[model samples]
Target: MKKALTTIFCCILLISMLSIVEASSHRRDIYDYKGSSTGFAREKVNYSLFNAENFTGTRMDLTGNSSADSFIGKFFGTFFNWIIGSTSQSYLSFNGTDLDFNETFLNGTIDTRAIAVNATMKLYVDAQDIVFNDSLKSYTDAQDIVFNNSLKSYLDAQDITFNDSLKAYSDITFVNITGDTMTGDLIVPNLTATNNITITNNLDIGGNMTLGEKITFAFGEVIDNIVNGVIQITGDLLVTGNVNATKFFGTYNWTEDSPLLSFDDTTLSFDYAGLNSSYDSRYLNLTGTNANQNLNVSPFNITANEFFGDINATFVKIALGSGSPTIDQMQEYLDNTGSSGFFTGGIISDGGSGTIDITAGQGFIRTTADDNAPLLSFNWSAQTGVAVTDNTTQYVFVDDTGTISLNSNEFLEAQDNIILGLATDEDGTIESVFNLGVRLEESIGQAGRFIRRIHSVSRDVRRGGLVFGETGTRNITLTAGHLWWGRTEY
Candidate 1:
């Protein structure tokens, strides 16, 4: 191995020296035209056994035969097999020469079966055509394409990919491309936009809709011709202009028994129960224009003038005689309106005034006594009908809670008349408490049985004024034989 390497080393040295000597001695003026080639280097040659002067061929040719046997004989065939020099049809002779094709490729084309360029050489195409009917390869710059030596392709015919740079579209359905204009329609199950969206044309939705905050129509009458529906707005729905509708209904359900409507605050319920049991209701209800309403809490009083009712069918036939109402007229009102007025059932408190001022449109009836000791009163202050004529006439008012009284403030000639009360024999317990009497007869009735409001007024008994007792008198008036003189207005 060592001798072989030494021989190789000597061969390479000789070749290098020969190349340097030939290059420096020739082609001294070869580079004057640098634009003629892409390479800047050239070489010249000198031959010992070569004679270009007598060579007859397109390139300098070696004679057909000779010299090889001589070389083999001289070197004992060691240089012979090593291929030093031999003159054959187109080869080197005893003196080695740089073989060149005498044909010029300038203004011409190269005709060859194949071309294997030297690795260090370059085939430049400078402003000229390099006809390649097939793919030209062996590029190493990494930008030029090449096939992988060991990679496996899923499809050999088509292998194309796009990075972020040249891709034109992303997630989309059918795209309407009209010369790059962005006007298109998007149909989706749901859509959300952070900014405002304006629909220039009609947008029809077939399903139910829900909105978070407020939905406003266009500014002026935009929601015109809108009909009412079951869905309602709980919050304040404001409309600045006049709202016309065929009908408007209140959100309450009124019944026949208690037809007047009221509402609960928290639960938002409509309360249609009766206010009390005193006044029986006769309800008449409906909704529309000219609707007559009779459902009322009976004694929602307007100060009455006179009230008339048939004694037999009292509530069935009546009249609200429009005028000023008084405590004297209250009995008439109760008879007509089916109310518990002063003369009959309810207690009538006249405040502290011994004579009740039935002039005002308001009064109170306090029934705070025991069940057996049901006492009624009529109190007053500065009233005109029942004059207060000192302690003597002060008997006009009630003193005991269970006793009948008629109180007055002054001393009179004892001529006060029956002003308010009438002859009412409510189980014969009533008595004329304002009367000034000389003869009287009646047993004090037991509690809850019979109480009397006795009228022993100072009057000419012979003239037969307001009187209340059975025609079969318990006490005969010494003044008159006439019995039951007063008109029984109750």
Candidate 2:
């Protein structure tokens, strides 16, 4: 009982000392890593005495203060280390004097990247994935636009909206279609709507669209060389640039560069044989500028009175005042269309050449049947002015460097003559072409139409044979998983 009371008194004294230590703040030796240019930096160093430039054979503690070989009962005039105890460990710190940190501070390098903001944070770029751009694109791939052949007659190509506030092209969408047939009126009043259209390949349109008004094209939008159209304008027409039309029905002024239709002062001309360099302009002009008009066809080489593209079309019309005329008046109109009747460019010209040789006079038209009605007449006109050569039989030669390996089960059918050859040692020379080939021609008699002509490239194989019949299909059989050739014996 006496020993228990003695332990209680010592416990109370220990509790009082612990309370003082809990209330005080210590300078914690924080590992402030300021530079880790690479990675982790933790180097070990030894501790030593200051006076002697030699280590005490002891290492510094983690706090870089306490040493393993610290001196006991050592005091440098009121400067004492920590009290030597056996229970809890405490670091010894000396004040009023500078510490010799010559080689004792370990892990002196700080990890600069550990506290860097860039290394620890991430940047976002997509919205749906919880990321975003600066202004945040609000696009959704819900397929709101549709494309199909049903849109042909609908003219849905002009699917543009006008924003009155902005006054510019906004909400632009690009649509593409394949094998699409567009038929309806695509009226684009403001031509700027064409900016957002792309056609990668053949864009076949089967209808017409009125560009109406206030629409113009950039340089490549319409090709000047291949622009084919028939222009029919009734009112006053004004064209700032050149016009390329197959036929024009309006009274207009044309320059020398205007094709098909041009005006040489008073003469209105149309270009015949536009696809050739040797072309002519057949025109008709009035004799005087005043009211007493005398029409003349002073320009002749003018073969026909009809236009090419017009099929059975009455070019001009005349009103008869709803009154009938006599045979004499009808005959006069049929001869000249003089005042009463409009001109019907007779029956189609059968390419006959008959010259009247009446210079600078009114033209005449005579209509008649060919070969007196029932006939099988031959007509020929040799191409003049151009040099001619000994005409040879035409054959198509297809050259291929590598082997054209075909499936043994599939049939290689040809319409006319199919010549399979090596295309010669000289790549595309025609004389060297027919050296190696198998050709098939149609026979005159009905027993067989296809005639096979084969030439041999190998002496060991059966090279030539004939196939008599209509154009039929034959497969190159596979005898042993390889294509077999030379089917016929001879």
Candidate 3:
């Protein structure tokens, strides 16, 4: 009985396993093989039908030489090699920083419509012409486009303006220059003669220009100009302003009015012919050697050490020789000397044969003070040509005042009348004085007798009596004569 049961269980389990395998096989066969052998063939592939022309999908026709296939195979081979981390190159190679072309050149023109380069780009080509239709801005390290080892010229259509300053390294010459207006200052630091610059038309400098070297005007004349330094010209100079020079040599002929001073040859004449008056108010000064200089006209005030011509003046005053005399001293000297007229100062001494004759007026000689004695002593002989007299002859010494005594060797002799007490008052009136004379008159009836004139009459007479007395003690002494009081007694 246990064998029968074991055989039955085995049969059931096999049936169920077979069922699961059959279902799985059917689903796979329907989905994978389209459920039949007639829907799918199991033969070998036809290689001739698998060509690029026969296929309607995106395809590439390989050349007769199979270049496309060779290129694709080579590209895949290089890609696989690069995926394996290899640096081996077939055409292009990149060694981390540089892409090398491996000395191969591109033959065709590459039209890159727009390109941007973050780093510096360099083209190592010869004879390349690059043109730009739009603007070209260079933002290099120096902010400049430098054409190395070449000369370049620029032709600007509009205004080529510099926002800051514009500098030129070499000389620039304008060949076909038109109207160029520079609104700013053009600075040239070192301009040599080899560096030449040419410009046409008018050059108007609005600012101050300093010239370090000498400037020469070869042909044209300079008008409305001033030269600060000394100017020497070969031509004539006509100055409209005043010329102040230290020394000037020229000849001038003036034809104006009022010619006060004139120079002719070696003579400087001050002609007052054009003046309104005899004296001119202008001053004439002469300097230098006075010996050779001559003044043709006389000036009002002249200062000189010596005068050559005659001087006529109403009064002549001479300075004193000695001492610095004041006005008071001069007045005292004039007053004491009693010389109040002209020729006030001088000493006139006649050492030669000269005489001071006073024929017209009365001559008076008196001492200034009373301490000086007045004496009139004469020692003149009747001899001619006697400069001095000898003291042997008697001279009458008369004392006009005080007591008079006669010398034993001298005698008084009167030529005319010897009148005593003859005086003149302030009114110039002559007064009566004691007159002792021998007057033989017909009215007096006296002859050869001494008479006294009193009121034009003879009153008291004492013959043979001598009057001897002083000023207040007069006494009469009679030897043998009678004295009458009111008449003459003989």
Candidate 4:
């Protein structure tokens, strides 16, 4: 009974297991054929397997057959064909046609000997890396070729030909030509047609340069006759024709007696000639500090309107207005100006009308005419005893021998007008000479007499007279005299 129950349990577990297996779903693999449940396995999956919705993509998929829509798909579709297409061909093949790229970059050196390219637009090459071993044929059409480094040719006689127009070669910049020889006509075709060569630094030419026109320079300075800019010459200058200048700087010393003339900033100098003869001309020698300004000329002939400074000359002739005036004319001019009045020979006079005239001897008086009678006469040589006439009378006379005489045609009048004398006047009784006063009278028998009434020491009135006798020293006689009065008759 135990064995049979065990068999039944086994059978029940087996049926349960078979029923569970039949209820589960079947799984599809990569090799599964499409459109049929029972078909042969495939080596590759279909395009639908690589679809974005089918796989969980993480990296690049090179072997997939999807459309070139993703980044990895575009890169593989673009460059993979170009790499795998040609083994030994001129151009790459893509999908049985020629392949082209928008831009291609080659990081390594291209073996140009094995492969050549005919580019339509442009071929950019690094001149530093690539070197042409053979001759490159010139293009028929115009093309722009640039060299980053030197564009050198190993040929000994390589020539580059340019077109007549050279239209497109207008603005080629930073071209450095180091070769010494440049044989061509370089033209600059412009509105104002001129071929100008500009150098920024010094231009040292080993040979000579000839110019058909003049040269122009900016304004500069000069030193040691070596001029600077506007024009410069380091040699002497000689002109064949006349030279007109504002000032000349050099000296002119031509002949032996010729005058020397030179000019400077401050002065113009003129010197006398030869050394054999005495040079009387002197020039002003000017210096930075002290300069002598006194001009000295030995012989100078000048006609000028005015003259200045002190003039020392031996002979001088001057024309006053028209001609030379005489001394008398000059004196007349002085008389008109009232400028002539001086004492000469102890006499003074007005220059024009008043003149000194001698009366009798060397004595003088200012009178208008020579015949005018003198009021006083003086005799320095001899004495005269004649009484003066009326018109020609002498009121007083003085001689050199200390003799004074008073002569008049009228009475020899004298008056005791002063009262401070030794005699006192009694009253106004000295009205006339007949009165008892001091008086002079003239008579035929007597020479002259002086009569006067005097007072004695005892205050008595006495009559005294000075009698001019013929020959006597004493001529005074007092009629009634006191002890102080003496009477001497001769």
Candidate 5:
């Protein structure tokens, strides 16, 4: 019994020694401790035997070369169940060179040849991916594409190529293409119809191009020149430039159309070579010399210094010089009613010493003919300073019926002395006896002097008679002389 107890005791001591060895083999370092809990502490002590360096260097390297039988026999023991078709371990092989993954990661540089999807493919490049392909022809899987590049030459002919099956949509906005010339014809397919088409360069519209609407050239905008077929406008045309048209026509078709011409507060100058018109009339025609002529329409309120014209109207008002215009028989035929008249403000004439034969109906005022033809005839030579005073308080009979009565209070005064006579008939015979009177007042050496005289003459069926009488007082001391008088009558 003592021997049996000694054997059991020895077995118990061996089991304790194995437990100590197991514990020592799994003893963890400070860095290997994941946690301090009971379960985690046990795992940490077990896993401490396989450190990163030892597992990678010694354990995995040895296991990678060992056969399955020897590997299991050495490490896992005889009771270890085999995992079928599995190697003891596997390792990555590197021969002191860069390890190229032949298979690209999602963040690695892509081989364009490897970009193949059955349908439309969209490959998005990340920031870490740097493409190295000089020519982009290797990417053939996408239906639509968008690329962002900093270099402009990347889209040049050498860098990019197109597939005939693919449709390209390129947009390079905010890119300026200045100072570049294009040679071929450019065709834009989907532009709508408009009134104006603007191009930066000169455009040549080929063939007989037809426009659907009217073309308007705005004011202050210039068109260099136009070579056209025909421009037809369905409305009014306003032209400010020199027009070279085959024909021009205008008509008053609207009810609100004004006259063809209108004048502002300005002058209209007709400098044409000649003017012609039909069925024209005017209210006033003030014509003058052609060189410096002015056809003034309204001269009523004009303040100019001089005016010249042959003013023919209902009444002419002359503001400056004047003369008596004769209306001869021919002029009378031309103007039957004498409506064409000249009424001047003032008139002065110097018709020498001969008698001025002022015909009937001719005077400053409007006149008409009658039986007593009171024609004015002035003989300046025989009428020098003639003083004729009709101061009698009696009525003078000019003809058998016509009589002129003088004012009793007023007398006609003349500066000089002259004989009085009447207008003669066709036989140069005096036609009537006109009553007359004479008075003289003078100053001799500054003293007042008065002289009065009276005369009476009558022509009748018998021989006419003449009587003379005088009575007055003079301030000067004078002696009287014999006075003689003569009278003649028919």
Candidate 6:
């Protein structure tokens, strides 16, 4: 009997242990396992075990809405809640502690209140609350916060801190700041750095500007009233304005050796009324005043209209006006460059019925040569006039109106033939008249020697020698070797 009782006690203990295992197994199934509701009767299963009130440990379900709630809502919520909640309640606690559900951690709707985090501060949100504190001096340990739309009021209130490696504020505006140095590209919708802004170093602007009428820089101020004004200069102050003034003047040194000023017009004018001027040996100066106005240069008390010079002390002065051109002075103007000199002096004319008077130097004539020596020299200083009128076929009227005179030392030489006519009784007939004054010479030695003399006149009718008949007779003396012949009718 004693052995049976002991065995009976052991069996009862085993059965109790088996019951506990079965209850724990069922609890594990409710907490860690998930299946189709169709597998078990809904009325027979316990549903309260999956609720937040009864679920005590980490639970993972693989099916149903409960599975989604567990993985997305519960798992991430619990994790972040614990982390943030442990600090204080200064931040909102998740579910009841100091944490909250961040929708970024999951892809579905979640009951953030159901998730809990340990925190110290109470989480409160006011619509009209000041988002930024201007008086907050230190940003060394500040936390980050994000806002929806613009932070205009925040930036206007206080200076913000950027602690990350990269930070960006797109489409932002800030107004009214008092700071000495700013490092970065400053983009403003319309900015005016006005009045007494001094920059010691380089200021690089990377854009263009459009101006209205004019821009002025004065009183040690550099003002850019246009948009995106950029002035890039390598050395000194570069100004883009209609009027620019330099206060403390200094000598400007240029790196480029050749400097040029170009104008895109056909004419340029300059008025140098009050400016002092000097010219260098290496520079050429050209000045023009008006459209048709001539340039006059007065140097060394010698006034001139135009002066052209070279490097070798050769100079030429030209007098330009409406009348004739005059050469005032020339230094080394013409040299021995295989050139020739020409001098013309004479007069000539064709004498006919009209009275033509050719003076000493007034005529249409020219003188030229091949070897730079005068070939033909003509001087029509004296006038010779001869007049002859045709009266008949064989007779002409000669009128010696002017005094026929010739130079004593200059003798006239006739190489061609000469003809003379006399009056006749027939209407168109001519006869030669002989006089005692007519004479001829045979040689140069007999220039004044008379070779022939007329004595008498006769006619012959039978031989037709005197067919017209001769009526005039004259006597003349003859030389010894000459013979006198006469004719008579048969």
Better of 1 and 3 by lDDT: 1
Residue 134 in candidate 6 has what lDDT? 36
lDDT of 6 by residue, 149-221 (tens): 2354555454444211123342133322224244444455564653555554454565664444234444544
Give the Cα-based TM-score of candidate 3 against the true structure.
0.21
Q: What do the candidate models score in CA lDDT, each in turn?
A: 0.36, 0.32, 0.35, 0.35, 0.33, 0.34
Residue 387 error for model 1, in Å?
48
Q: List the residue pairs that clash in candidate 3.
A: none
Q: Give per-model TM-scores.
A: 0.20, 0.16, 0.21, 0.18, 0.18, 0.19
Tell me the tens digit of each residue's lDDT in model 3 across 1-490: 9999999999999999999876655432211222465655423322222223222323322223332233332343333223222443544675443456644323221223123221213342222324221223333323344642122333242224421123132124322222354433345554445343444344456666664443344465433334675453444567879988885445444433456777654455656655444433444433453444545443334556866554433122346665765523333343344311111111111122221111111111223223222212111111112121222221212222212222223224232111111111222222211222222224234421224334136455555545453454575443555565433454
TM-score for candidate 5, residues paired by index: 0.18
Candidate 2 per-residue lDDT, tens place, 184-257, comes to 23434344454456433454455664553332244323322222443333334567899786654535555666
Candidate 4 residue 389 Cα shift, in angstroms, is 77
**Comparing candidate 1 with candidate 2, which one achieves the higher lDDT?**
1
- For every candidate, C-alpha RMSD to the true structure in Å: 28.0, 35.0, 31.6, 32.3, 27.3, 25.9
User: Candidate 5 on 1-490: residue-level lDDT in tens?
Assistant: 9999999999999999999887677654433325655633333322234222232222221212333322322343222333423231232222333223333343333444345541224343432235524224455323124443323345454333432111132223322332233333445444566445655565555545554554545443333333465444545556669879686444423332224333332432332222223212232233443435554534233334664565443334433335764443332332343221112111111122321121111111112332222222112211221112332222211111121222223322121211122222222222323323221112232222111122223223223233344457643343333332222223
Clashing pairs in 5: none
Mark the regions of model 6 whose C-alpha exceeds 4 Å error after superposition: 1-157, 160-180, 184-201, 205-207, 213-490
Model 4 is weakest, by summed lDDT over 10 consecutive residues, at 416-425
> What are the runs in model 1 whose C-alpha is more than 4 Å off?
1-185, 208-325, 328-490
lDDT of 2 at 83: 45
Clashing pairs in 2: 33-110, 33-111, 34-110, 35-110, 126-131, 152-183
**Candidates 3 and 4: which is better by TM-score?**
3
Ranking by TM-score: 3, 1, 6, 5, 4, 2
